[model samples]
Target: MRTTRSSTSRSACLPSLLLRGGLTAVGAAAVVGMAAAPALAAGSTTVGPAGDYFSASLSNSATLTVGSVTVTCSVSQSAPSQPLGTNSANQVPTANSNPAGPVTSTINAPTFTNCRTNMPLVNAQVTTSGTWGISAQHGSPSTVSFQIPQGGLEVQTSGLASCHAVTAPDGPASVAGDWTNGNPASTLVFAGDTVPVEVTGGFGCPTAATQGSFSATYQVRNVSTPSSPINITA
Candidate 1:
């Protein structure tokens, strides 16, 4: 009778142990699945290869305007020395979504040449203050929206004695445009986008205007691989 009772107890506990073991195995599998989930969702938006330098040249004459005063620049360019950075697609987002940014680099101040204003400042020179921010906010596989953050673009004018002006508080200005990846070179197009600025100057300045507009097109080329164009991909 003792042997039989021991055997019966062993049989009953065996099923319980197996049931608990099955539940533990299922839990472990769930954890493993969770761990592998992120690997499947790793799409991204990237700008060229990492650490690449690039230069942008104006494809068309650029313009800077405040109210009735318009400054047309025959040449404009940005040279980026900082290494390029990468970003995830979710971070940059699409044009339809609210996008953050993948600020690639702080570029050198853009140079504007042959700048002549609608006002009498024929010899006007456009000089920028502070480092400019290069960022990608939204896009598709071939195109992305670009930004130069506020304070990234501050233009101080110097030429004639009566033609000294500056964008107040460091321009409190920004640049917004679209980038389209292409062969030979990528293109950035700024179609007369306007931002707020307080223009202060001695005389013959557009102080009455509260906003400024920039319009230009640029072609971006990779410095390292001159044959390859810089690409912004999502």
Candidate 2:
């Protein structure tokens, strides 16, 4: 009779122990599942007026300063022959969404005019060579930042014997700026951007400097449809 009673007691406790163990295992599994959940997915980008040419004109005068020399350009893109700059394909209907810029376009060099140096009796001439490129970098709803590929813009400066400089012998300089979408035209602003340049002249040159800076604002418009503004959504 004593043995039977002990056996019955053990059997009654078995289900309770099993239930507790199973509940603990399930709780741990739930926690692991939550921790492994994935993040939100990104959407694709779209551009308006697809497959159209766009030009950029200076909304403000451009300034380039290297060491002791400061050059200001008053006229850019006044005529068709002296176009400020051009970019290929104002449209990318199906572009992958990435802040690191998976979209790219070919860009031409810009011409500067009415350029003069801060130093008296010294003139400034700026020349650019090679086909540059622009790529999307990062952006928000209203504006997007772009990265101009390096080594595409070769800025060679020649003028008075006292003031001459170049970007690099084998390599060229590049820049970064922001673009804002609008109706009539888009805007590009370069606020005190730093570019690499070296001085290789005799007197009054920024011989001791290894870098140069420039600032300008440009308004972009579609050539085919002057009223259509370039729009980039990411």
Candidate 3:
């Protein structure tokens, strides 16, 4: 799936050698701004910079043994709070900032037919061909996979270098994958259903370096029961 994606890029180029405190400085600046922003109950995940000769691997029940992939994701529930501007004719009360006030949930039901066509990697990976030459930068491609099962629905997510808060990001996008295990003759059994995932933006990692380490959670939803929740305490 060679679909167009949106990602912010910079022209600053660093030497091939390890950056001495360069990344640390950049992260410190971004985190300062993030802390001043409001907070929410939801969380996110992000991966840091890896070496050029690195890997982007996505796995599951029946793994894809051929092509390579790496996916990134960030999940947050903090809504931006824009203060009342001075241009307003009347004075307004100071907006109350509440990180634990309430959360609004948006729900949807997608198909789960257990067919290959029904489920494919999210952040679709398109094969781009070019000469393996130096002087030009190479892009790290990845795939996001979510899983669904007959027992319940599971959302599995993954991300690459930019999945981190202090790097390039494509916001968030969601896709569903239909998963099935076993034969199709008579005793066909479904394992899980999942798809590509695009979550919210921001630093999902919480570390002592950044006040605390990042914590995140994964959930499962079903018709017969409430979603099974995983508390992502980073």
Candidate 4:
């Protein structure tokens, strides 16, 4: 975000006028200076890999309200450390480029709140595998955009005997905000957003239906921070 400068200006003679009346021109100059000052500093912000090796983790949490039931979901993911290049000789970072290799992420044990009593599902677990990418932008404070490719949100659920695991179709999911370089903390936080996820399992209770299909917009989040650069032999 940038702040615009005020176009208001005072006449140069006004300072001389004030000084002639036994009053100092300091107050008048101060007023003019304040009005002319820009509301915000100007600079380019960018974010990307600081070194050859990069690693980060993302954490997500959200609440789902189905009919009258509300369930809370929490997920934690760890991305494999990726090499920007073989060595510093070719480790030059580019603006708006993908990582050197496909970065795989593992979803940790996910937990839900008030799921058993409110919904037909007994327990839910996300798939262990997922993919991520970083899009770097050029500027003074460089920014990096994070994204999880489509079809990356794989989920498995366990419930009544008739219920079975189902996978959500691939769709593009991304962090709500960009991560800027030179932040105090290494970790970057993302806001929550809704993602459409498909599931195949038994619906209802007692006479549970088998092979049922359902689509829901579930809330998800990504919170990860890159690790410091590590030197590698070319």
Candidate 5:
């Protein structure tokens, strides 16, 4: 059985994988182990700089099948309340703030089917963590992009024998959108391809095989004022 893995690129914002504090980048390397704790529940607000601080969640979901078993996967991320730093040129503070907190991704409700009697698939959950930032970009609407640098975050999963879930770990993963007046419910769609999960422990499939890939869309909203849109200032 032959499987392919996704490729990633370096991030300009975060050149170094490790930041000042202990927060790790997202697209680094996969650490085979049990899944980490579930990300903080959605709706939790993180107060930051003054421009546009909001909570964002990935809307698109993907399906990964192993042999006869299939599972639906989705991810969500929460920004931190503290400020990281300000861009000297633009004079605007970065999103989620300096010494940024860990932005976490949680897989919503995963289940499995079609497993052997003895090696039945147990609980399944995948979590990704990384620092986040907003960068200035040149375009029609004058937009800013959100980036989770390579090696800035870590991916892990729990439940399937030696199988562990891994997201984009080699390059930076980001999404951008045009400046919005103030629509908090606006959705920013992007692509997060190839979540290669390793299946070991003689669980019927070959060891270290690609479980499948996932594509996601994120919805950005202001938690403070649910009805109001988040204001983005470049």
Candidate 6:
């Protein structure tokens, strides 16, 4: 009981650029900076068929403040668009689409149920089903978040990615193994501020396949001013 992909739909590709921010304490000054690598574009500017490209798509970036330092940055990411859902397998003469494959859920148990089987006392065996559906569409980067340790946090995304070639998560499927978009998450730590805890997650599908919709969200939290925030960038 899985879904299929459509021909009119776009084939998908996933690429991700993950960043982490950490804070350290100085006397009384606040410092902020992008984690590890300096702020730079990391994903596909334009996705093409294996060896092709279309246009330049850039991610959105923002800044926040704790005491004095201001970190400035920009993100550029993109994922391919997906197509209409697929037809049931073996139902030939339908149409043509990429074999939607091994898209997995973040959780091993990702379904809702309503029956404890055999015990039919006050209720019947059923599930008040609500699927945590996923799709980091084409030219979409599943989940992309940006943060300046001492500064603030912002997000720019199209979607998360799945292992397209695996072909399991979505049935009648092929596997699109390990594309990098559908699963979305990001964080920032100032100078060493460890109090104002901040975190986010893509609780549902960490990896996504083709045929679904852009149905993912991003989150941000600022525990306390990033401790000893230092200015890594402007």
Q: Rate the local accuracy (lDDT) of all candidates.
A: 0.41, 0.41, 0.15, 0.25, 0.31, 0.17
Q: Mind giving the per-residue lDDT tens digits that candidate 6 earns over 119-222?
A: 11211111111111111112222221111222121111123211111111122111110123211212211222211212222321113322211111111111
- Which of the two candidates, 1 or 4, achieves a greater lDDT against the reference? 1
Report the lDDT of model 5 for residue 57. Answer: 53
Candidates in order, TM-scores: namely 0.62, 0.65, 0.15, 0.41, 0.44, 0.16
Per-residue alpha-carbon lDDT of candidate 3 for residues 1-234, written as tens digits (9 for 90 to 100): 111222222001100000101111110000101111121222332211110011111121111100112121221111112232322111111221223331111111111111111112222111101111100001121111211111111112123111211111121112212112111110111122112222222332111111111111222211111132111111
Kindly list the per-residue Cα lDDT of model 2 for residues 1-234, writing each as its tens digit. 001111221222211111111111110000000010011123344455665556667766776644334556665431122232332323232442445333455444455666665554455555543443444433453333222223322233344343344443344333445558877877766555454444445443334454545666667676667777766676
Candidates 3 and 6 compared: the better one by lDDT is: 6
Q: What's the residue-level lDDT of 102 in candidate 3?
A: 18
Clash counts for all predictions:
1, 0, 26, 14, 17, 59
Error of 6 at 106 (Å): 22
Which portions of model 3 miss their true places by more than 4 Å? 1-66, 69-168, 179-234
Best by TM-score: 2
Q: What ranges in model 1 sit over 4 Å off?
A: 1-43, 81-103, 138-161, 168-172
Return the TM-score for candidate 1, rounded to 2 decimals: 0.62
Worst 10 residues of 4 by lDDT: 22-31
The candidate that wins on lDDT is 1
Q: Which model, 2 or 4, shows the larger lDDT?
A: 2
By summed lDDT, the worst window of 10 consecutive residues in model 2 runs over 28-37
- Pairs that collide in candidate 2 are none
State model 5's lDDT: 0.31
Please list the residue runs of candidate 5 whose C-alpha ends up more than 4 Å from where it truly belongs after superposition. Answer: 1-50, 59-71, 82-122, 136-146, 149-160, 168-182, 192-212, 224-228, 231-234
What would the per-residue lDDT of candidate 4 be over residues 30-116, giving only the tens digit for each residue? 000011011112233222342232333223333332223222343232322333233321121333132231111212112222222
lDDT of 1 by residue, 119-215 (tens): 3434454554344444543344232223232433344444442333333234233434556777888776655554444444544444444444556
